[model samples]
Target: MVKMGVEEGEVMQHSMLTKSIERAQRKVEENNFGIRKRLLEYDDVMNSQRTVIYSKRKNALFGERLDVDLNNMIFDVAEEIVAEAKEQGNFEDFQIEVIRIFAITPEITAEEFAQGKIEGLTDRLFEQAINAYHHKIDAIGALTVPVLNNVYAERGQIVENVVIPFTDGIRGIQVSANLKKAIETNGKEVFKSFEKGIVLALIDEAWKEHLREMDDLKQSVQNAVYEQKDPIIIYKMEAFNLFKSMLAAMNKDVVSFIFKGEIPGQETTSLQARQVNQAPVKTIETKAELVSPTGVSEEDVNDGPKEPVRNENTVGRNDECPCGSGKKYKN
Candidate 1:
């Protein structure tokens, strides 16, 4: 499903839908350039057919003629098929071409095809080819429908996993998730997330203030459960389960969701429900120093590769007797 966003004031910017339309427009324009290039190739083929037709007309004996004459007329008609068909097809004779490709699949086993059939076959050889094709095609046709039906049956099982039937007993809370970053860019890392479980009717300071109060209550309720000094097993149900029921009753808009199979540990529910978010320890770069207790400038520290020192006293070319060669430096 698609939705649009609107604002009463301030910045008048493009919504998600508007951005999608712009992107689709750019794709259409890009595809049109390629489509025009392909049409030029088709036009060249049609012109060649017309040249052949004119060539055939030059010869007088053309009435329902056999061999070459009949071949030329067939090519001419094939070149002039409808534009709808051109768009619907991958190629000019897509259906015929697809059938011809698959026709080889059942006929002449893969091993025999690898052995390679010779070219320029005789009329008797063509009759043998016709019999071979019919035999293979009949075998495939008999089994294909049942095979296709089983494929659809498997597809139906897949569809059931995603779709759970809605009933009167089931209450739906339509929590809005901004999947724009994920869907628009089609990125795996981009996510649909919330600040907390708290939903805002309209995200404003007033709504945020209410959320803070509710968070305070939620924490207090958890703390009270611990103070009672009861068994942890029974206390958890009262602390978490009943609180969730009250939260669900508070609004018809906050969705209760859990990521797949992530049951809460006996010790901890969800760590994300904590009051404050901490930047991970990995975020700190130990090599680079920050402002320290001492008033020292960071720019004073050098952070670059050291240069290699040149070797000294390795050779004195002019006075060398190491090899006793006449060509002193050349050696």
Candidate 2:
């Protein structure tokens, strides 16, 4: 019985393979049009989100203006936090949340917040956040942009790479410096090489986690129909919420890592995603090569061989042959 069962399983596997191959053969015979259409229909929704994420990353990687980018992100985060807290009508919770996310305690006292309008309270919070950032930079003599260098031990030498952090959680590297000569040669490039690697690292890490969460969310949402709800509608709504949450989390993580995390050095590396360009290769076609064509390509058929050429230079059936043999076409 065991042997029989194993044989039956093998037969089923073979049958499945046979079907798959037959389908593939049909597709080829049709000129591979079926394959193209299938690819176009697959994972279209996910591709849109992917494009947006990649565009954000690309902008961060190549954008030159760090201050403007950082300022915008900081403002955006502040706006989100303020908006979230506005409904609660609790200034204290707002302050606490601000400090928790920005790592800067608001200087405004509770009494002052209570005495003032919400707009005033928010302005005060923004002021404190900006001041806190300025103060940190002032102390580090990084009143301008802060350049960072990564230090690592390599072959009895200290190697350094300059990393720059822009505001949008994208980082750039200038050049690597040799530790032995770094002190003697404090070139602009050396300082320029210093960047904020932590921001991009945090954003990328958070985004990846968000994608994983979304995948799980999607898989679990198929059960929504069992609850007497439309799964498609539920999935779309939940997916949107998930994306918004992911964006919020990314901003918060970027801020937290930038302010509190240690600068990435040779021990740490830049967080730029590697870009690759790939294209499908075309192969030489043979007479026997089958290609699947779609309905449009095969719909029209005027059977038999097409008309033969009868141009000005060509001989007609009743005219003499081109060879000038002086023979009629019938002859």
Number of the predicted model whose TM-score against the real structure is largest: 2
Considering summed lDDT, which 10 consecutive residues are worst modelled in model 2?
271-280
Quote the lDDT for 323 in model 1. 69
Q: Write the per-residue lDDT of candidate 1 for residues 102-140, one digit (tens) a residue.
A: 222223232432343322112222344345434533443
For candidate 1, list the clashing residue pairs, or say none: none
Q: In model 2, which runs have C-alpha deviations exceeding 4 angstroms?
A: 1-42, 64-66, 115-120, 142-196, 227-229, 262-331
TM-score, per-candidate, Cα-based = 0.15, 0.50
User: Candidate 2 overall Cα lDDT vs. reference?
Assistant: 0.55
